[model samples]
Target: MTVETIDTVVVGGGQAGIAMSEHLTSHAIPHIVLERHRIAERWRSERWDSLVANGPAWHDRFPGLKFDDLDPDAFAPKERVADYFVQYAEKIGAPVRTGVEVNSVTRLDGRPGFRVETSRGVIEARNIVAATGPFQKPVIPQIVPEDADIFQIHSNRYRNPEQLPEGAVLVVGAGASGAQIGAELMRTGRRVYLAAGPHDRPPRSYRGRDFCWWLGVLGKWDLAAPAPGTEHVSIAVSGANGGETVDFRALAREGLTLVGRAERYANGILYFGAGLVQSIRHGDANYLSVLDEADAYIARNGLDLPEEPEARDFGSEPECLTAPIRALDLADAGITSIIWATGYALDYSWLDVDAFDEMGRPAHQRGKSTEPGVYFLGLPWQSRRGSSFIWGVWHDARHVADSIATQRSYLEYHAQAEARSA
Candidate 1:
């Protein structure tokens, strides 16, 4: 096997990897990005066809590139977002080797670096940056029975409503993806049932500007403090047209049957908990808490902002607030498709290093791994709440690159001293 050595090796060629490569190049660091598939493979293959970015285009810009020509306020589609990454790689001439799958990453016994085994060849590097973003693999619950007659698919594989069988659809997990997909399926004149969970649903727009703009002004996106017991809730706001809010209350009013958390699948039946109304109420309370914090911040800073809009009373929809049914037979309800939007799981099995925590996740502090010369990027809450977003990875990437440079300088100094002594 051929062996090549470099200063650094970056795994995964997504936004995080590309951003880190740009910073590493600016620092004159010799590195290459290894991708198992094409650049932005997840965005291209995993997302739905009609999906657009959850946030505005303005907030999704990378470090050196801006969406100058595109409307900053409009949400860019999935294809456009994927193309942006492709264009970025070309613009910066990033040293990305596509289709190169990493087989293993192991530390050198006596050396001061690591050996990365790949499908193409083996690379020895002083530093290794795992830039694989948070959504590593699709998570399908084991509770789903294998012998079921109905067709099932994860949100990653779902394209559009037409892709599924002609019948009612049950979308499990009412996060951004689940809510959006359920709403879209409803528009197709299909009956949709959403297995709701405790997920915060912020208004799409507030006053005369987007809610994201408010978050930016309030410094909410840059917050790094650990929020206890709120890890699974997605911060992504829904992207429904007509400036309409897309929360549980809104979806309920739009003819979506809201169920409780899914328990398990029995003999042709799916069981649910009885906390549907409680979950929705709790999620709304969480949303209100965020707005209250923003309001307090504005008041304390004495900043002149737009007048708060009059609140809409969602209490009129009392039917959605009722107790959920404990179980529903799939055949009786005429439901033929099940879409699991229960989020994703991280896989670092190829990494032959002991840098993971009890959850099998990489153990890193602000992108710096516990193991020397190893780093991680694109992890949710890695440095701040925005660490996993396209616009946020650059901040962590810059820090990791600087840390690598400092370590490289020290190694060189030590080598020179040893040569002089010899």
Candidate 2:
């Protein structure tokens, strides 16, 4: 295999990687983007057809490009977002090596650099940018029973409801994806079940405005201020406008059965505890508590916000669970199609760097990692609102590239001084 040397090597040519490449290009920094597949391949192949982004067009843009002439509140189709990523890469002229799967990255002994081994070839770089992104793996719970004859798939593989078995299908994990899929299935005359999990509660319209109007005024606008610890963990802003005000309410109203959290699955049977409904009730209360906390924070801080946007009420409460249903319990509900929307984690075993935290995520502060000349960009929650959406990644990528340039300059200055003294 041929070996090459470069100033930087970016792993994964997704939005993060492409954005970083653009930043490096602007500064005349030489870098190569190594992608396992074609750019935006994951989005094109993994996401379902009905899958739409919670973020609007303006918020879904990348560096040097803006998603225009699209509905601001409308849920953008999967294809549109995927195409945007591809166009963004080409627009910036990123040097992307497609079909190259990086096996491992080992630190070189004397050069203080990294040697990246990939299927296409081997490359040595002064710095390595791990831009694989958080959505690298699909999360399916072990609670699903192996004996169940019913079809089961993760949100990644699911494309449409027609692909599911013609029976009552249970969707596990009632986050944005699960709730949206469950609601759509029920509308299509399929018996659907949704399992609830911890989620944030949204208001009808704050006082009397579009939820996004308030979010833009209050949440997205004040991005520079550091977010609270709670905000970093979970923050609830209004979802896209639809028939249902909230996902849980919409799914419940559409004749979808609500169930308790899945305890354990075996022998084609799922079991639930008696306090499942009570747990749902507690979750609702917890959501309200968090919202109230956020409101109080806004009031105390005296942050200027827009007038509460008005929205029509979609009604409240469902008859099946008999409790204020926010989250669905998996075990109590006999769901066959277990769609895990619990979230994602970064698993980087191929990376030999020791700078990662216990969770396999690279440890970084403001895009600068502990390893000299190395960095990361586009991580979920990397900086407040930095990795929340496509537009956010550009801000992070610029910051990281700037830091890389600064560090490279320092290294050059020290090296030249040492050479002259010797």
Candidate 3:
């Protein structure tokens, strides 16, 4: 087999890969990006037509470019974002080899650093950037009963609610994806049931003022600070900081029956925590009192300045309490479909790196992995609010690229001296 050598080989060509490629090219670094398919194929193939970004356009912009001629608050359609990425690749002249499937990477003991096994050929590079995104694989919860006759699908596979069954639909997670799908189904007049999970629910605005504005004013998105202790404070949860809250909650108020965490589904019956439905109602009630206290805190101390972090927004809370039941009970309520809004998992089995922790994530400091030259970008909670975000990947990418460049230059200088002595 012929062995080709390069300074670096970047794996995966999604948003993170593109950003890394751009930085490498700008520095005139020798690197090639390997993609499994045509660029942005996931975005083009997976997203729905009416889907807009849960976050605003400003938060979605990639490195060194802004999304102009678009509303900042509006979530750009998937197609638009995909087009932007395409244009970005073209503009930067990112060296991308599409339709190449990388099989594995093996560390070379001497000379050519590492060898990448791919369908096309073997590539030898001193460094490798695994830009494969975190959400490459879909996660279907184990709690989903195998014996259940009802159709079950992961959120990644879900394009729209058209494929759902006729009767009422039950959605399992309440994260951004879960909430969005739940709200959409409800809007289509389907009887939607959402299984609320441990998640933050932020609102579109705070007291009529856009929350995005506050995020900017607070300089929360700035990349200057190396590390902030309270970075994951209340802002960690979507609505815990007293934002407008999610569209899912609004849907719940509309008519969607919010359900408890599903323990399991078997024999067409969905089992949940005993009295969980009532417990949730009780929590909602207490949350209402908490909300009142929060509102009082906010009112006492204007939005401009508060003595301490604000309380969670619950409006006034629900007055009613109810008991949780099994999925078989759904038959009585006429619920039919099930949307597993459960979140995704990170899959790195394809990569031959030994730097991963028990959770399958790379052992890294900021962006530097335990492996000397290997680095990670676009990981969730990589740095701060910007870590896993599409726009935020650049901060980590830039830092990693700089570190690599410095190390590469040092290696080059030492090699030159050895050559002269020889």
| Global lDDT of each candidate | 0.84, 0.69, 0.69
* Residue 172 shift from truth in candidate 2, angstroms: 0.7
Span of ten consecutive residues with least summed lDDT in model 3: 232-241
Q: What is the C-alpha RMSD, rounded to one decimal, of candidate 3? A: 5.1
Give the number of the best model, judged by TM-score: 1
Lowest summed lDDT over 10 consecutive residues: which window, candidate 2?
229-238
Report lDDT (Cα) of residue 116, candidate 3.
89
Point out the worst 10-residue segment of candidate 1 by lDDT.
309-318
> RMSDs, each prediction?
1.8, 4.4, 5.1
Candidate 1 local lDDT, 1-422, one digit each (tens): 66899989999999999999998998899999999999999988998888888888887879667776678888888888888898999898999999999999999998788999999988999889999998988998987776689888999999998899999999998888898899899988999999987777776776556777777877878889547777776543676563355667667777888899899888889999888887888777766765676677778988677766454456555474665678999999999999999899988888888788888778988988888989999999889878888888988899999988888888889989999999
lDDT of 2 by residue, 1-422 (tens): 56899999998888889889999998889999999988978778987776666655645576477766476545567777788878888887899999999999989997679989989778999889988887877777777655555577888888888787556787776666666777777888888876664455455344333444445655643365444533423322323343134546556776887776666665656654455466455446644543464466568877665533233233576775675333433334444466665556567878888777777668889668877766877776687654646777778888888888887889889999999999
| Per-candidate total of colliding backbone pairs | 0, 14, 8
CA displacement after TM-score superposition, residue 127 of candidate 2 (Å): 0.7
- After superposing candidate 1 on the true structure, give the runs of residues whose Cα lies further than 4 Å from its correct spot: 242-244, 297-308
Alpha carbon deviation, residue 249, candidate 3 (Å) = 4.5
Position 152, candidate 2: lDDT: 72
